[model samples]
Target: MQIVDRIRETFRENAAMLREIENKADAFFGKKNLQTSLMQSITMLTTRWVKMPVTP
Candidate 1:
């Protein structure tokens, strides 16, 4: 279960950073072009993460 715990910890850290990113993204929400760019980046990361099998 160590790997699972480690992955959970990693996700927790990412979640914390996402709070700040939320504020940053909010600042660019009104700009459609920038919003797309930010969303694309986020999507790319999430996609990569989802592909990894969480194992212990």
Candidate 2:
């Protein structure tokens, strides 16, 4: 009975840790995604500006 309780407690602790890690990973990726999106937008705007003909 004691061994069973120990295993159950261990599993619960591991599950909580895993959830925390997953949340952190999700947040990290979310910021990365936002950065990527902003870079793409900047690149597109720069390309458009470069392609425009210069007027005196």
Candidate 3:
């Protein structure tokens, strides 16, 4: 339960960080730029998840 709670909290923090990044990207660039960069970021994150190592 404690580990689950910590994971939930970490996810919430990450969501907030992602929102801030999107806002900053949109402000400095534009919707199109934000879309492109966000797609790239998603791809990178997906790749990382796919390649994540498993511990025994």
lDDT of 2 by residue, 1-56 (tens): 99999999999999999999878876977867867988999999999999999999
- What TM-score should be assigned to candidate 1? 0.42
lDDT of each: 0.88, 0.90, 0.94
Off by over 4 Å in 2: 31-56
The stretch of ten residues in a row with the least summed lDDT in candidate 3 is: 22-31
lDDT of candidate 3 over 1-56, digit per residue (tens) = 99999999999999999999988878889989878988999999999999999889
Candidate number achieving the greatest lDDT relative to the actual structure: 3
TM-score of each: 0.42, 0.53, 0.57
The collision pairs in model 2 are none
User: Candidate 1's residue-wise lDDT over 1-56, tens digit each?
Assistant: 99999999999999999987877877767557677888999999999999999999
RMSD, one per candidate, in order: 12.7, 12.3, 9.9
Over 4 Å off, model 1: 27-56
Candidate 3: regions farther than 4 A off: 36-56
